[model samples]
Target: MPALPTVRRLSLAGLALATTVAGVSMTASAKPPEPAELSAAAQVNRTIQGMSLEEKVGQLFVLFAYGPDAHQPDARNTTLYGVASPAEVVAKYKPGGWIYFDGRGNVQNPTQVATLSNQLQQAAIGTGLHVPLLIATDQEQGVVTRIGPPATQFGGSMALGAARSTADARTAAAITGRELKALGIRQDYAPDADVNINALNPVIGTRSYSSDPKLVSEMTAAQVQGFQRDAGITATAKHFPGHGDTVDDSHTALPTINHTLEQWNAIDAPPFKAAIKAGIDSIMTAHIVVPALDPSGDPATLSKPILTGVLRKQLGFRGVIVTDGLEMAAVRQEYGDAEAAVRAIEAGVDQLLLPPAPAVQFNAVLDAVRSGRISERRIDESLLRILLLKLKNGVFFEPYVDTAKAAEIGPAASLATAQKIVDKSITLIKDDTKTLPLSNTPRKILVTGWGVSTTQNLANSLAKRGAVTTVAQTGAAPSDAAIAGSVAKAADNDVTVLLTRKAWDSKVTDKLGKQRKLVNDLLATGKPVIVVAVQDPYDIAYYPAAPTFLATYGYAAVSMESLAKALYGEIKPTGKLPVDIPVAGEPQKPLYSFGHGMSW
Candidate 1:
């Protein structure tokens, strides 16, 4: 989906749905009554003392709110998001919390999300002890946004890094948190503390703030303050001990970091340490195994030494420790969900995130306690931490959110702020020929790329600037004939602009190799070939010969529009490189430094 239309359409759909399903029921009047005057610890102790074994177990597991396979209009009957319905899952497992995921087809917009949260909370309130669910999601604004449309989307961590403004970081996070809070979400798994040092790292690419631990540390701390203090939402510093240095993605298989303790402390551990000192509410464990931290090669999620020893005792982190999804292969391949859950609790993780089989995991932990394998005191400790998070975020007294207000907030103020930040994040890698700030004179322009929508938007923007533009929406590295046809048409244009979207290529095939060849082929022509990297800035390493190169570090419509404005000298390019782009066969040496950027 195009970035602009995605937000606009999502907002409209969410508003319409909110009017139909939510209506006045989601107003401030729906906010739950304030709990009795008692300290958070006192209330948690009282609640825990009254809870049953099943209720306590339920509080430990955070399951996906909707079924994954539920394709029907009534998704509650599907088995993908665990059980038949949200109410059914709550009643059956008495889960401590639920997370919304769009990948499972259970999520649509902010309206449906708010309604679902309210419904899930109602079910949890009806259960024994009536503890509110710890509603959460990966609302990491940039690439990993769960709640779509209507929610004001920002340029994420790398963009913040390029903007290099702690004030902007805090403001962006605050906007994200405010929007999430409106949708009844209390916890944000964001401000990724991972310092992306390895260029080949797949998952943590733009999600990380910077390669510099100092920058990542300051930005993450600012993000936490924005989410917790400004938006009144619990902020979680994630993928702990750093998932940035390793090339392997934990989502697929277990990744191990062999860096020594000294290296880890210098590069990866500083951001997390800064987050802890910034008074972060939660810390999420990575699925990767750091051999330096734990010699057994166990994923940190399942390691007692890393979770309890390093994070708890060594770092002096006192907040809740959450595990990265237990369903991930990093943990699941070695130990099943049930065994993993038991071990994770034993590892001192306060919350089990997205266990595939919540009931089995719950039962396994329950049985472990019964068999004296896992003590009741341990469970109580986790429960206290969980309850403390809810209380700290005001989840108990104000779980229900004003959906109408939420619909108004994200789109109204966020888009403007996002545009400014994204504009600032537009990095000029190499403008040797000074082909940018294209003249206002009428000229033929050939705008072609596999990323169709963004290129199309760029074409339209160029047309408005008096350049007669033609678009060839080549889907994912066009064929030889297609490239020839595009080149033939480019012969008619004054300048050829090729937009490429590639962060990391698959191990199976060099997917971006074909695209790189196309750019080089286009450059072979006499016309100036301007390469705009919409996704990853590292693409310039492949086609450095391109006369002009720009890195937006994003492909959103706002980013594209900002690029267009910069091209016309309306918005001067100000963004710097957030990560080093290594040349071929030189992993340690970078063609461009971290702060490299130039403008006309």
Candidate 2:
């Protein structure tokens, strides 16, 4: 959105003299070109053609803030960037986008978030840059949600996958997108397109839709439409070529996938293809390496063969391609600070996200363009995509939001929609003792488990149902003393409802052993034990002897309400398993096949 190049203006006498010298008639051939006649793409090209080398490089970066205010600095988080405040950083670097992380003090309430976004935008525009800054967040809901209460916390992709309803998927996306747009955030890194085929995947368990590529494809396409067409915010289908099969977290270590070219085409490629067909404006690259696609051992973020060859040529996606955080160990496995940005751009990625040293990365790429290692045309290709997306998503015209109005939206109605999604996704995977549909409304219950918020929410939900509820203080990874204390408390309760987390994983040896033991010991007390798996439903496979079990896909508040209502038979459980759960020691055998659900 830089200023359009204009013809020189002449004074009245000079205009008459020039017109006489030119000897042109006052006709169509003599009419000057108007800005309104330019195509959107042409205007974007002019904007890119008008940028400085520094501004063009700035257009390719999306950095996260550590401080709270635009002009004020935070002392607690000073490690990532220098001591510059958020506004100061924007003025200095002029990043094309700014992403918020609540853990870094960049986001708080709706009004505060809106104010911060406006301040960032104001700073960027103040630098004589005509295009508005793209504000974003990882509001994927479920576990990775950055915003707090008052914003709708939808059960993420796996919940929609479990429900197996594209309407529900679209609804989830629309609601979350509305909340984001209201807060002046124009983009969301959500609708995770990875097929969660590996049950033990450490990073992308509930983030992905399902193990089946067809289901992922349907949900991915629906979400793309919801986010772009319905909600008017840019949706990024992320972690390309599948991050769902890895056991290692990319934040800490590098993980490699051995899926053959055929396997990738069948498993990982479909969701992206569907996304492209659905007109997804942004595609985030995976940091993991796919040996079958590229035997050169480069991760997809740096591999030109994977990003350019397969994604661009084979799939024909002309949208903006973004990289995962360059600070992550997966991208940093081979290269360091400066070269990562240069190589990622060389690989056809349009945006470089959250590299550790933004200044170093920016200068290196600028120098590369000057040294002829990377062409200026290559940079313009990326800028064209970015600018067109900005124009498409209404970022240029409507970058600001009413801070007060933003605080009012996405609270009641959006939360109801979010709960509706989770409510439909509560899968009753096991019921051996018919312990559900409790006849006595005032039954004594113990809510214990991995997620403290979920446990407390479940306690609140059951209490509303007239049950005397007791919540144990055991953390997710509990100690033996805490488990023993919870067991002692279970003797008084009529039914002990406990939660268990990840159990079936090769990398994790402990495997939620204490949570499993807590459930068994609770059952030994002659109390009806209702176990709910918050994250991976495979948590129940470790405790095969349990009488009653359920899989909520996630531990969102709505899931707890669904669990409470299903327990009392107020509403029937209609959800099915999105993935197959294996027995404790057998990875190949299935304990409960996909689409397994029981109802009264």
Give me the candidate number with maximum TM-score. Answer: 2
lDDT of 2 by residue, 1-600 (tens): 122233222222332232233232111233343333234434555677679988988989998777667877765334556655787777778889889999888777888888888888888888887778988888887768888777877767787888999998888888888888988898999879999887778899988888889999999999999998889898999888789888788888878998988888899999999999998889999998898988888889998999999998888877789999998988886888798889999999999999888778988999999999998878877776677677667776566778888889666777777777788888898899988778755678888867778899989999998999888957656788988988888988888888776755534633456666777777888878898888888788788789889988777777788888888888788888888777767778888898889998
TM-score of model 1 vs. true structure? 0.90
Q: How many steric clashes between backbone atoms does each model show?
A: 6, 1
Q: lDDT of all the models against the reference?
A: 0.78, 0.80
TM-score of model number 2: 0.92
Candidate 1 lDDT (Cα, 0 to 1): 0.78
Clashing pairs in 2: 70-87
Candidate of highest lDDT: 2
The deviation in Å at residue 448 for candidate 1 is 2.3
Query: RMSD in Å for candidate 1, one decimal?
Result: 8.6
